[model samples]
Structure formats: structure tokens, C-alpha cells
Target: MSAYGFEIVQTLIVDTEPDEYVKRAMSKINAAESNYLAGLVVGLRDSVLAFSMNVPGTTSKDFLGMVLVTQYFVTMKEIGALSESNPVFITHGPGTVKDIASQIRDGLLQVNTTQN
Candidate 1:
């Protein structure tokens, strides 16, 4: 992966909080559309992150970060959102976005720094 020079990481912040989280997710979705349309109008970049997800009602804060941590069904339903090369993490118990994000961050803290 390091050979790529610069990596394009896509992250999704999963949570179901007061309406604020939902609004932020929607904003990211719209940003994706905008980026896609811009690429079409202009031209695609050599290295692209292309962040995307199936929000159904939930999903990321950073461009190069975790994809999402929604309910199992929602995550499965958006399987297409992930690249074939990317990894998927599943949590069995209940947790908010922060809880799950923190767990993942701590687990991978040595590997990389998490950006929300």
C-alpha cells in the first residue's frame, strides 16, 4: 500500500444520535455526488479516494478514514460501498458511533492515527 505514494482512505462514522449526526452524513453523501459530477465535468484524478456509502439513514467524517459502523443489516446492505481490497470490522454488542470509533481507534492506534 505504501508504494502507492499517497493513499486515498475513505472513512464512515456510524451512529444514530439526535438529528445532527444524520444531517452530517447526508452532507457527506451530497459531497460525494458533487465530486462525481465535478470529475465528469472536468476529469478524474490519477489518485482518487471516491468516498461513498449507502446511508439508508446512517454512516464518515474524514476522507481517508473508516467507512461506517451502522447496524449489521445496514452495513451489509451497503457492501458495495467498500472496495474489494478494504477490510471490514464488525462489533457484536451495542455502541454509539463514538464508542465504536474509539474501540477501533484504540485497537489500531499503533498502526495509524484516527481522524474524526
Candidate 2:
């Protein structure tokens, strides 16, 4: 039988620290949303990477990659204030707010970057 199409995947930093890592993840997601960043939940294994706003073909995809990395850095800088019981955190869904945060921290962090 002929071989099937190979799945090409984008690589991301799989964080597994605990609590702190969670904050970092949420912070990035939050910053992305705050910046009015546009993109779908491409993947949610470790660290998240939202697609960039521009649609410049492959270049645009690369930009989305940049956004993901940049957001991670931004979050790391402010991880000190992140806590584990932030009310803003969500409690359901695959990429639910809480899951995203804690997943990075290896199921320790529990904060939500969303406001409201």
C-alpha cells in the first residue's frame, strides 16, 4: 500500500515546572488576547502559540510562531505576581483558561490572565 501523507507539526516548548510555568503560559495567552491577537487554538500540549494577525502566506505563519515565542518571554518576565487561585481562571474545555495555565506548570499553576 502507498504511504499516507506525513503530518508536519510545529514544535513548541513543553513546559513542566509547576505553578510558575502555568503563570508564564497564561501571561502569554493573556498578552496575546490583550494585544487583540487573532488566531485559533492551534495546539495546546505544552506552551501555547497563537497565530499572528497578518496573513502573509508562509511568512504570516512564521509571524504567528514569533508571536508565540514572544508572548512566552513576556509572560516569564511577570511570573512573580501570578497565583494559583485566580478567579479569572476557567474550569472547563481542552484549551480552557485554567488548563492552558496549569499545563505549562505541569498541573500546578491556577491563574487566569483574562479580565472581567
Candidate 3:
């Protein structure tokens, strides 16, 4: 497996009316000189709508820490790119990258169990 580097530079979180915020957020994203931008809109139970935008590159997928490098590290370790002794960034501290990926994946599933 190959390693990739994302040159993300900006992040914007807007909590407001979705209709207005979506338009404004797109405007800003398009106006920016970056080659890539990803956006997500989340609506809560209390009717609170939030819009988040990640700019510049691939790191945008990690919006809420939901999409992280743990999975990639796991794959790398399987292919021998990483060793069991290699430490990786986990929830609070460093841990065995290969060992923690599955745990993190499970935890993320639980956190996102509710869907709209």
C-alpha cells in the first residue's frame, strides 16, 4: 500500500440555517483557490443544523474524527509496512496501530449508530 499526504489548510464549521448556510458555504469553497473541498451538513434532533467544510485536500474526510488513518495504518501493518511495535495516534494516546484499528472502527460504528 502507498502512503498519501493531504495538504488540507482550512476548516469551517457553521451552525445556522441550512438553506442560507449551504449557499454561503459553497460560495466560499468555490471562491477559494484550493484544488479540493468537501462539505457535510448535519441536522440534530433539536432542529439545530450545522455545516462543515474542509478545504485544500484529502484530509477533509476526517470531519468529526470519524474517518481517520487508523484503518490505513491497519492495512499497512498487514502488508508489513508497519510493525506491531509502531505506535499510532489513538483516542487519547499512542497505541499499536495494527491492534487499535479494529477497536476504533467498532467504536466509530457505535457512535454513528443513529441515522436519520
lDDT of each: 0.58, 0.51, 0.50
Indicate the worst ten consecutive residues by lDDT in candidate 3. 40-49
Tens-digit lDDT track for model 1 on 1-105? 669787758647565465988889999999999999998656433222233443332223552234435444476657747667466665545455557667666
Clashes of each: 7, 2, 0
**Estimated TM-score per prediction?**
0.24, 0.22, 0.23
lDDT digits (tens) for residues 29-65 of candidate 2: 9998966633333343122323332333446435544
The residue-by-residue lDDT of candidate 3 on 41-104, one tens digit each, is 2232122212233333434234424334544545555756545555544443345543465667
Alpha-carbon lDDT of model 3: 0.50
Q: In model 2, what is the error at residue 100, expressed in angstroms?
A: 9.5
Off by over 4 Å in 2: 1-58, 81-116
Candidate 3 Cα misplacement greater than 4 A, ranges: 1-30, 33-35, 38-95
Which structure among the candidates has the greatest lDDT?
1
